[model samples]
Target: MSSIASQSRSGPRRGRPRDPKTRRRILAAASALLNEGGIGAVTMEAIAERAGVGKPTVYRQWPNAPAVAMAAFLESTRPLAPAARGGRVLEALRIHLRKVAETFATRAGRNTALMIAAAQNDSELAKVFRNHFIMKSREIGRTLLDRAIASRQLRSDLDIEAALDLLYAPLYFRLLIGHGPLDAHFTDAIIDAALGGLKRRRRT
Candidate 1:
């Protein structure tokens, strides 16, 4: 018999079972609140009311409002896969940027911006944002950079930290400035300009 069958026959299941549906409902309620009134709108009481659960339930799951907001933000803005792999690092970077642009163009984008502003004043929120969001983006960039280095597509001497900044700083600038909408063409340009220097080749 399968392990599941064996466990069933042995006795009742053990350990704390996770209710995925309940979690999804909570996240959905949080998202709706954020969409309606930004981060400030996502109170434990509000989420409980929206999700048809008690305030204690929301509090039990997440310690604070920022924690819940961070969870909701992550749920809404889960990063997409690299555009291409195995070859064409530049192409992959471009695709990734385009996806980011699209994400920032929606209601989630506004909430993200507000959350960032709030995080500026809240150290705990700042930590959550860095750990949950910024670090993930850095990890993806680092992986791509590592692959490029191994392939001799980019210079081994390049600083991965600085390289990540060069690639992402412009995107943040554009978003914060409201300069223009993030688009394929804009991302393509950023990739082209950045790869020109980072790429392992002599310009002549």
Candidate 2:
């Protein structure tokens, strides 16, 4: 090896090095506690203990319980599979909605429930939740919808905003209102009804 090659191999590396799975374990620990007992249960000390890491480790990643909960909540609801190009939009929509349903039905659901209630009274948390969760989720849905519209799979003139609301609002409604089930059958119904309206009409 040349002198320059040796020097290139030895220069200081950038950013915090990935610890393989330590950080994931910490986030997992944080999420576990948050899911099981809500925000009150997710302390830095408890997270460190559960993750089998030092307090400094947990603190190094997240400053507070809310921060951890926010990260975990976002992670739990992250898009499962974004629709591929030239793929079936309806199936992709169903897959994404199914994950939403699953998350709302799980322990992380506990954290979401508290966030919803607290958001009503706590302005700051509400803003954080809206920015991180609501906005991000919609962006995901919009990507799928945009692809369909671009490919002429759906009508070009459709109202994307109202269409998005119709696609996702019902799931949240079921979660908060307890009016009905958020099952696969329900998911199918949502997919069909929403797509039915968006589909481009065939010329006679």
Candidate No. with top lDDT: 1
TM-score, one value per model: 0.80, 0.71
Model 1 / residue 77 / CA error / Å: 2.6
lDDT of 2 by residue, 59-83 (tens): 5555555666666666556555555
Off-target runs (Cα >4 Å) in candidate 1 are: 1-18, 83-86
When summed lDDT is taken over every stretch of 10 residues in candidate 1, the lowest stretch is: 3-12
Top candidate, metric TM-score: 1
In model 2, state the lDDT of residue 125: 51
lDDT of each: 0.71, 0.70
Displacement of residue 59 (Cα, Å) in model 1 is 0.8
